[model samples]
Target: MNNKNINRETIIKFNPSQLVNLPVFLLGMILIPGLCLLDDLIKLYLPSGFIPEEIELYIRNLPVYLALLYAIYLGYQILKISCIRYEISPEEFRYYSGILSRKHEFIENYRVKDFSINRPLIYRLFGLGNLTIYTSDKTTPVFKMEAISNPQDIYKTLRGLVEQNRRAKHVFEVD
Candidate 1:
């Protein structure tokens, strides 16, 4: 019945930070250099005539090729994470994600059962955290908003909105 609760405006809309791929990026950083080094070592240690010229060239270039492939994989990871978006409103929580084919999903605020915030050491360093939402919706029982900034504030807002929506709907969790 409250006028404030009647408004369906979005309280928060955010895309997960590209830093979500930090670990992968770091691993790639290490591996790419190591791979290049391995290629050099192969060229130095292997005898000039130990193998056919074509095979020898392929062996020497293998690491460089792998490094290129890993670089491509890293780009894809960053792009996929960037495409994800989350929206919270008084009535529902919406998630949109996809690279080529888009998908949209939502859970009513009243369906939210619990919430948790995880701040890993790396994420804490950047003031980022993941918010996990437990909902009664069958299709999406567990949802995670990963590597988003200021998760605690968003958690509080969503908790309050979920309580208000539940009260308005007279929804009770019997468990």
Candidate 2:
């Protein structure tokens, strides 16, 4: 492998890029609870006979329930997105995922056949894209990196490393 272009010590590691809807999700996380609290405050100001007691109780409690549901959904998203990570080394591409326990997968650069970067309109707006690597590894024929920034550069680096590794290995195919 060419040692000059590749840096053995400088590993590229990063988490998933923030989604375009991230701000909306975060707003819901705060707004839901605040609205629920406000509902309770409004109830204290209204006269006791403004509505039937049973109906009033349900109406006041609905926001809290909605808030609870939204909280769970938001928490799940945070956990899933935070747990996933990508790492690019000189000779291998690694993907790490899982919440409590971790799962590690490594793909040798030499086995990569080709790769492509997809920058859809929305992803481009957010400075994020999807990178797909087609490889000879049977366990994982196609590895994908989603919601990553600067996918074009990453793809180029990975493609260069794959070429270098293949050349070093003297791998050749007739077909």
Candidate 3:
């Protein structure tokens, strides 16, 4: 008999959606191919035997170099997003983020002291904010989630869970 029953269900799971804008992604996809086509059109219209062989070779290969550079940059962007993940469960909040190396951190709900949402001007324009979690945990005292949509809702949900967990654990903050 094999039993894989996970007791806890995820309350919320999210990535950095606000950081990956559809228009920006589409623009990047179009820019390279458009530039290559423009290079081809320029070569076609040029006067007969005007550009020297070395210069022509360099010009013809310029698009390939540009494409390679863009590919490397885009790869980094994809990896940056792929490497970060945030999960909220009833008992704990988890953060996973790294590239080539991996770091996973969990803060129990009872340890969470306070959390706040900060929306800079640009993030406000995009309807996104950063969630900052302050915990009593020694390893990661402050954890931040950037470019998350509707962070206030998440903060309220998290605050409720924290209170519930603290009650269950019989932990009370004394001032």
- Error (Å) of candidate 1 at residue 31 is 0.7
Off by over 4 Å in 3: 1-7, 18-67
Provide C-alpha RMSD values for all models, in order: 3.8, 5.4, 5.8
Pairs with steric clashes in candidate 2: none
Candidate 1 lDDT over 10-114, as tens digits, reads 878888888888889899889977997898899789888869999988888889789888989998898899889888899899899999999999999999999
Per-residue accuracy of model 2 over 1-175 as CA lDDT, tens digit each? 1123446642577677658347658789688778867887867775677789998777777777777777787787788787898877778888899988899998988888878788878789988999999888889999888888888877877777777777888875334
Total clashing pairs in model 3: 0
Highest TM-score scorer: 1
How would the candidate models be sorted by lDDT, starting from the highest?
1, 3, 2
Count of clashing residue pairs in every prediction = 0, 0, 0
How far residue 138's Cα lies from its native spot in candidate 2, in Å, is 1.7
Instruction: Give the winner by lDDT.
Output: 1
Candidate 1 vs candidate 2: the TM-score winner is 1
Q: For each candidate in the order shown, give its overall lDDT on alpha carbons.
A: 0.88, 0.78, 0.80
Please give, for residues 69-108, the per-residue lDDT of candidate 3 as tens digits: 8778777777877788888888898888899888898999
Q: What is the C-alpha local distance difference test score of candidate 1?
A: 0.88
Better model by lDDT: candidate 1 vs candidate 2: 1
Q: Which residue pairs show collisions in model 1?
A: none
